[model samples]
Target: MTRALPSGIGLMPVRRPDDHRPRLDRLSAVPITDLARRFSAATPTSARDLDRLDGDLMLRGFAPVGTGVLRRILSRPSFFWMGKSFRRVDDELIAGHNFFTALGGSRGLPFAATIGPSVVDGRPAVRIDYGDPRLAGPRLTRRLYDELREIEPGLWLGPGFLRIGQRRVTVCWFAVDSSVGYGEVR
Candidate 1:
């Protein structure tokens, strides 16, 4: 059975490498546009899989949604965001927050969200919504939306969007690597 892609983005042509570390490294070196395209080609993951990623302290990698030097700069660690932590809140939704390496320790931020199954860009994905007043901050954080797809055994990728009135603006591209931790980046 062949399904149509949503135009522009297409399936990633290269076969995924066997070793996750090399795969992650190769992905990290690709252009942001390629990352987004690869994400579209990836498989949608379940909340149970995400919950299993808990306690692993997923390593974070990101790229800006735009082109040029700033995009590359932001992708590099400036200590703004470290990684994310996931926990199952119920059968359907998974609760998690961004954990930053700050103040001499891991500082989990209040930019939390609930993860669940959803359709994004015409394909199945796991969504992260920060709309709950109790989970996310009442202001800007509430406008943030994200989604993820599994690219490898323990690697996932997604885009972060900011809701502006009726428009959802793509702000950045992010990845969570469950295969590695804070102390294991090489």
Candidate 2:
């Protein structure tokens, strides 16, 4: 019979020593050689691209774990944008403000212009437009992630844990193509 340790001591019964071994169950399926090969082959120009690709590949390769992490990051309330120009009403609206207005104005038609308050926030809130319709679908998001990965290799990609508002959140970055688009990730 084994003697019980004192209550104050941080000692617990050891069942099987082998049972306590770190399990690599989830990591086992992924071939390290293949991953290393792919990583080595990748020629990302910047961190952003690397991050985007990392997130995409992680999601595709790991499924539930990848997606679960992404959802947590994106769902954070604090990950939103906020401030003034976001709510400013400009009298002389630029052509790029609205494609419809730009086209109509160019055709010598009077177009009404208005400004409304908008919230902008996220992991990298400065670069994203939260209300964009293209960002509404997962497929687009994934595609964006892939494109960014290729274009900006050095950016933070996704499928990783982040501490946000006292909770762990997972976030990802992706790209989208729009007829009325402006600016790059930098």
Candidate 3:
């Protein structure tokens, strides 16, 4: 029963090649202890929710639901083509962007998303927005929005529902291996 972001809130800003100083929300500004706690509570639960846990949860932007539960959505074939970037601006702030291609292939559009500090779901979680991380820059980045909960220092997980053909499938978790995530890509 989760609802999508409003129609025109726009995408979160991303660091562009030309901009030397870009303004972004600093996660450090938010309470650390609370953020961590909220993240742990959002893990996969119940039969349907628990099923999403797989391999490399951190890399997929989620935390270990439990000691044994894992998540591997990022490397999943659906997200293999996905590329992302992150830069540590301050202590708690991790600036980044996620580029995915699903609806794009059929709709002739591109998906570029950004995540940052926010208060949603009645707790502290990262707000993910689809569109140009560059905003109104030359690229068509903004499209939709999703909220991610941090499981640990460098891992996150968020529910992603997508429309494929006629049915909308719920992609319960996504990983963002913030640590080594950007080592290969820009």
TM-score of candidate 3 against the unseen true structure: 0.37
Error of 3 at 49 (Å): 25
Clashes of 2: 22
Off by over 4 Å in 1: 1-24, 106-120, 182-186
Residue-wise C-alpha lDDT for candidate 2, range 10-121, written one tens digit per residue? 2211111111111212222444343333333334333222122210011112222356554344333222210001111133221111111121111111112122221111
Q: Choose the strongest candidate by TM-score.
A: 1
Score each candidate by Cα lDDT: 0.59, 0.22, 0.36
For candidate 2, give the lDDT.
0.22
Worst 10 residues of 2 by lDDT: 80-89
Error of 1 at 173 (Å): 0.4
What ranking emerges by lDDT with the best candidate at the front? 1, 3, 2
Residues 91-184 of candidate 1: C-alpha lDDT, one tens digit per residue: 6655566655354334333333334544345666777776654453557777888878888777788888888998778787777777663443
Q: For residue 171, give model 2's deviation from the true position in Å.
A: 6.6
The residue-level lDDT of candidate 3 at 13 comes to: 29
**Winner on lDDT (1 vs 3):** 1
